[model samples]
Target: MKLVLKDYIESLKEEGELDSLLTDLLWSVGIKIFTRPNKGTRQYGVDIAAYGKNFQNSIEDQNKEVFLITVKKGNFDRNNWDSGKNSIRQSLNDIIDVYIPNRLGKQYNNCKINIVVASNGELSEGVIDNWVSYTKEQGTKNDKLNFVFWGIRDLVQLTEDNLLSELLFPEDHRLLLRKTLSFLDLPDYDLRHFYELNEKLFQKCLPLKNNRKLIKNLRLLRLISNILLKGCVEMNNIKPAIIASERVLILYWDWFKKRNSFNEKEPIKELISYHFFKIQINRIYFAKVQTSYYSEDGLSFGIGNLLEYSLITYEQIGISATIGMSELYEAMVHFPSDPNYSETCYKNAMQVSQSLGELIFNNPASCYPKYDEHCIEINLAMILFYQTERFDIAIQWLEKLISYLRDNYLLKEFIPLFITDYEKLIQIEVGGYKEEISSSILITCLADWCIMLKEDNLYKNLIELIEQSLPNIDLQHWHPEENTEENLFNSNAMRETGSTRSSIKLPKNPIEYEMEMVEERNIFFDETKFLHNNKGFQHIEYLANRHFRTYVFPNSWRQLLNTRFCFNKP
Candidate 1:
């Protein structure tokens, strides 16, 4: 709840970022910004211009109103206050003398021009009076001209009043999380208070169509859900948590479904969909956890309705759509007892996955070829086909993935980069800076599928891929696990430690060395330099390892390595 307004302004990185946040805030409060600050060109002192009718009736007798907002950030002490105030006065002079005359002369002649000075530092009473006096001196006879100052206190107050506390001070999530903990601990849990509080909170957010707020709310809910899920499962009582999660999810679903007013072209829609899908994925995963714990065969098919709306609302947004459908399929695919409804969910997921696969193929770069989302469509399509015993069609899709990877990034040019700069390889695997095929994973996957089908045709492709992959990998210096088929097929073994044969031990105290290599191969190869930015490297490692794990290679394929096979690339 402590608003460090100066620190917040400093965190904005650039004037443009702050302007964007201000724009969203203004738009959320029913103020339509007609012009934005052009950083690439001259802005002429006016950072933004907005117009709206009767904003909370702030101005008396106002049919039309306009707000000219200027933003400045600094410590306005005695040393800098005068210069800062003069600079602002100059901008205001330009706005009143030149901008208003040229831009809004006839249209806003009857409109009240509310000149707002939003500053990160304090504005002393004398400075504020001087600012007001300057405006008054310029518009002595013009009653419609008004000046307002938003210093540190005013901006903090604005954030609180507009329910942007969560977006501004993320520490507010801890408060919400505390509330959830207390609610769960209540001996006689009353749904009434839970529902009431949620309704009130949502009502506060309802008017603000800003996606940032939506994303913040979604993140908060996910965090709470995660905490509740852990608490529920650990206590061996999941009913309360399940109820809470379902209630929150229903609220989110309703709110999300009603958001038809947002412009589709805005990048915020992509962000909104990203958080929205994460929320859905978390909610359904929790539901699955509940189902698994209770052994319940009779949960409602209401999620199908949610997915239907999701598919319609965000079908074009492929990553989330594909991920959502995949999670939905996993959640519903187990209920064989309810053949009709479960089958419906499964079929819907299949259809959506097929469509999403085509979407990715059409624009692979958007999906980021290194991202696991890149392979979700392929994994889903193959799994669905394999489940239905459609071996031939599944083989075709599997072959498509194999060909795609081989043609795209398994070339000599790219393979050597991974060998030389293993860190860049991690980056490539995670879709960091480039869109390249994960040769190791795709080869392993194809080997697994060929073993499953006992098809020599695809098996030959796997051999060729292995030949291509092994050349750059320095077999003499590189450690390979025991030639057991089991090790080869275990994607975790291949991904985490590179081979099941390697082992690493951490020091008793981490600070014994400047840095430590967690992976055995990286340590053996003196690859600590690659981990200069540990967090970024770890993120890449996680995504890369996860991408490798998405599709498992069967143990049956390992025996093929023993044969002296010479086959042309398919």
Candidate 2:
């Protein structure tokens, strides 16, 4: 496990990756971080500045001292040590000559300052003589100044001591963590094991009362997430990590929601930190896999991988859109002063929604939904377009998709059903599922979305077509159950879903009507619910779908729902 962590650390870059991790490490270790790494800032030589009790035993001055650290990436050789203005020695000199006199202030003047050089890899042996000479020369300037070098071993040891401590990471937890990193890029893309491992990890944190201990656990969780993301980045496939991160965030939110930990400001801030990290992962996916699926080499994967490749890309677009549109206001609420961020979210939403439309138009396979869960994706994309004021694209895409579903359903059982079996769904495209085609969760949702988008013609056509094509199967649209609030978050909660056939309506202004409709079904989506108008708590069908995916029922829509209201963009 130490080796695994060492390698993970070795993969970090100096500017943002290693820089952020170093600050997180410092916070977890009880250090007061006064200054941190900032991009576009002048080079004053101090990447990090903190004041804390001395942890180093070799230093006899045990009183509180300030730490001035300079961090870089990879192994430090002679070039890195004293190459030019950017060299380690030059940075250390700037910290002393410029920063201390100009910026360190009178408060820190009497305190012993430890100037440290750090990196993920060890300093080369040839630089030792130069380093010792430099430290000796710097020491003569001030008796209170001290110099230290932190190499790979020192970093590994410190991380283990602070973040992945023995008590926090017992042998079993260590094994589970190792297994998680190993299984990140597995062919199945099933993260049940990953979910279970995090459940166990979170469960372990609940009983401990010490605040510092909790910080260790949270920091460790972050380390594990980073390691998994790094592996996905290497493979150029980040969807699994994105899905896994959503699940982990859901698990964490569930814990907070259950305990009513709303008062704990720090954890919420940390939640935002993790949320931003998840968004970064999505950005990476967009940058690397842009149009790769719909390009000439789109369907070039081996037979086994092609189906999943096509299917998940569609799912990715839906997840991204839903997040952007829904969470736009919520994020702005957190940072209310930044009005420009709202525009950024709008731009991202438009880009992803447009990409989804392009994929549907260019790639025939993308137009096909391989599983009923794709309904959630479709709904999310539509809502994004609607909320972001891109209704034309939303309406057109929904109409085209419903028409495609009708045409495909008539020709063959091409519309994916509510089946969780991976092989069963893949078999639908490869050859055909000979079994009696049963109910579909997607078609009904599409009909509802069509109504929401004001496409009365398309909505009526879908209703009539489902009756003619698959007469025996009833189409489902999940609604709130009685006593829904209590059971909604329960493990074995039974959800109520009625046939769309029961309720049929047409409205000229579907957005206003849909708002009323959603309020009637689940009050959480109701903008007027917070007025104490006797409509506060209800089982939001979508929220429950994301929260209650268990082993027995792998709730295929979990990924889409988990990310729906959570924007994954900066």
Candidate 3:
């Protein structure tokens, strides 16, 4: 395991990969970093800056010291030792002649500075004498100025001690991670194992005795996830990696929200790093999905079976919808600081929405979902449609869907149900058994959109149709039971009552109905209502959909209700 991790560390790039890992290691072992890696700016050769004990490794306790670290990826050689502007030698020179004299602030200047040249690979034997002479000469100039070098072995040990310790990822979990990496070609089995690992880690972190340990584990999770994704990239299949990263993302969000650690630097920085990895995977997979958008199945990936066609097409469209929402979320969150940040995001979001619309229009399979579990993707697409205010297409689709399900009692073609058990869902599909449709996340969302859009007639017809055709279907709205948020987030159905829902409420006042649902669950869809740095309501539905492994649902409502894709002001 250590050797595998060491190899991945050596494979990392300097800008966003290696530097970020090193920063996490610094924080993990008690180093206080003030300036992190920021590209597209002049940093005087200092890739990272921090203050702490005289030595970086926690194992070697020493006197206090501050640090200016210049990081490089892979092996270091003679050219790196004395090459031109990009060389470590020149970087060290800049750190001393430029950063120390001008850039180092007064507050951190009092302590003797330790200028460390760090890399994830070994230093060439040819550069040994130069390193020795340089450190000796630097020490002679000023007692406070010390020079140091950290190679691959040093970084591996730092990672092993602080992040990859057995105390965090147990033997079974480690095996599961290895299996996940090996199964990149098979996205379903791959995501299953990955999610299992996440669930176990979440359970372990929840009862932690201290935040320090928790942060270390979270940081480790992100690094391991990135390495798995790197493997996916090498193999030319990152679909599983994208879904797995998204799974861990919401898992971390749930943990952060429950632990109230969003304000802490360590976890938030960890999230940002994980988010960066997610963007990388999405960019790669999005290109592949986009290229096939005008194809026969829109996302067939060459799967020839009809059932397989419908499954993959709807799933792909759902993923595209998620990508769109993510783009918009990024824009809204950063809008406060950078007023111009949203233009590109808005464009990207609409482009993705257009892809979804076109995928549905061109691919007949998209309208025919495989099982009730298909609602997860279908609902996500519906959210994107209403969010972009592409109501005509969405309304037409919803009417067709409601009419199809309302009349068909004999066939199990994507019938809505409350249960999320995958095995039972599959059995229903193959065994010729029909679903009771007692609980429905799909109907709930369709009804909410009808009311929100003031399609009063459609809303009334949906309500009456369910009552008459599928009389057993409750169409109940779900609400989080009192103090059951933890059980909800953890997917612990062992609780006495994790949730409750209402019978369909046909409100005469639509505005009052919207506010009542939003405030009832305290689910605010308006991003502007929350602080820029904090999480908003989208996460609630994300967590629910993920944990339930069925529908993109709100915990309140017959299981889906108030959530609108377009950031409804209510």
Candidate 4:
């Protein structure tokens, strides 16, 4: 049977009758766009490429870059090709070494090798072994090569479902189906025949009540449905077909509920019901209803209906307030904030928030006993309200929430809010604050406020505090010792008792000005030359400026430090 089909295919090809043959085969497989003679040099290294319009083409067509196609016209021998692998191995090697490198450039590393062996005969067990072994050898550890094998069996299977019969040729479809049927396992053949003979019976068995067997059978039916859907799309009536199928699924669900002992009032049923209804709403929104001049009636209807139904069902069941709060928050964040369409969404969100807050505060046994999540939500709402110019309410809410956090030892939770409020307070200049605060919260707030207010004194004080907190060691050396205050400021002491006083005289002018003068003066003299030649007084002015600029109160304390130290280079 395979030999006869192969001869017929070959005869068609020889007589230049392959256009119809190719069309029939492609149509049967649901391929839409067939590029004939795929006109390119070997740079493309692909033959007969077809693009599926339904597939997204955002990325470049990698199938054009690399593709493995097997064209077989003979009977496929899975066992023989597995046993005698050498002949098939050599054939694959010849293609890779000679055809790829010669036709495509030697630098064409991305080329995919395809094998097309059409014979007017059947392949033996040895031939199958050889093919499998060849493929295995060519496959690298990194999977740089891929191989796909096709035979008469595949062509026959393609024709079994009237795929080719609906197309331009019916006899060829019958022949291919008969050839493919010769290789099928008896059980699969039986199932296929049963479905072919009694389609309605198969559909009835698909939704039976046996829990263990029902899932398996449903999966099989789903596979068949997918194939049929693909066929419909190829034929270009997919939308209507899909709608009809969805309606049937809905009717089936209703029928199953009526017939089965399953309780439709169960929680799982409610969950499934919610999901199914939501899916239907989404489909209607995106599909059936057209846009209106003033509003998107489809979206409004879909979301509004879903929301109303969900709330009614949930309220009846006494659902968790947390679930309501979460859903409300999601709606608010996702949907538009427009006053027209979103007014209901916003009102519902607020209601959910309030109810959730009350539940958390009043019911100790509720999941959220401390109500930390609710507190965060309230803070976010307050922040949003503040942005919207509802300052009085925002401030009230913030104060209450901050006080709650402080009372509960959740000061960490309010740190960010504290910083923001502190900045606002400083901008308004309501209070006079003195002395350093220990909290990181207060320090950050004060630093940011000082920067914003342009209060140089406060800024300098903050910088000094930061410097003092830093580890007092020179990091340039491999072995560094702690830099004591005595080493840093001993010369500036009012008395010589060496107690390392905290108070040091501030520079007469701003430190930046002194540093600039020192930098300008030092540009004229070379420190290496001075050290090498021992020229003591040549750059005295620059040296004096460097000392004055680098140290605090340079004029008053310069003599004390230099009194016992002298640089006499040899």
TM per candidate? 0.39, 0.83, 0.76, 0.21
**Reference-based lDDT, residue 73, model 4:** 34
Steric clash count of candidate 4 = 17
Candidate 2: what lDDT?
A: 0.65
Considering summed lDDT, which 10 consecutive residues are worst modelled in model 3? 524-533
The lDDT per prediction is 0.47, 0.65, 0.70, 0.33
lDDT of 1 at 448: 45
- Model 3 per-residue lDDT at 208: 81
What are the RMSDs of all candidates, in order?
Answer: 22.4, 6.1, 5.8, 30.1
Q: Rank order by lDDT, top first?
A: 3, 2, 1, 4
Q: Which pairs clash inside model 2?
A: none
Q: Model 2, range 339-371, lDDT digits (tens) per residue?
A: 666667556656766665665555566567767
On a 0 to 1 TM-score scale, where does candidate 3 land against the true structure? 0.76
Q: How big is the positional error of residue 567 in model 2, measured in Å on the Cα after superposition?
A: 29
Best by TM-score, which number?
2
**Error in Å for residue 162 of model 3:** 2.2
Question: Candidate 2, residue 262: CA error in Å?
Answer: 0.8
Query: Compared with the true structure, what per-residue lDDT tens digits does model 4 show for residues 173-208?
Result: 334334333423332232233224123423544456
What is the RMSD, in Å, between candidate 1 and the native fold over all Cα?
22.4
> Model 2 — TM-score against the truth?
0.83
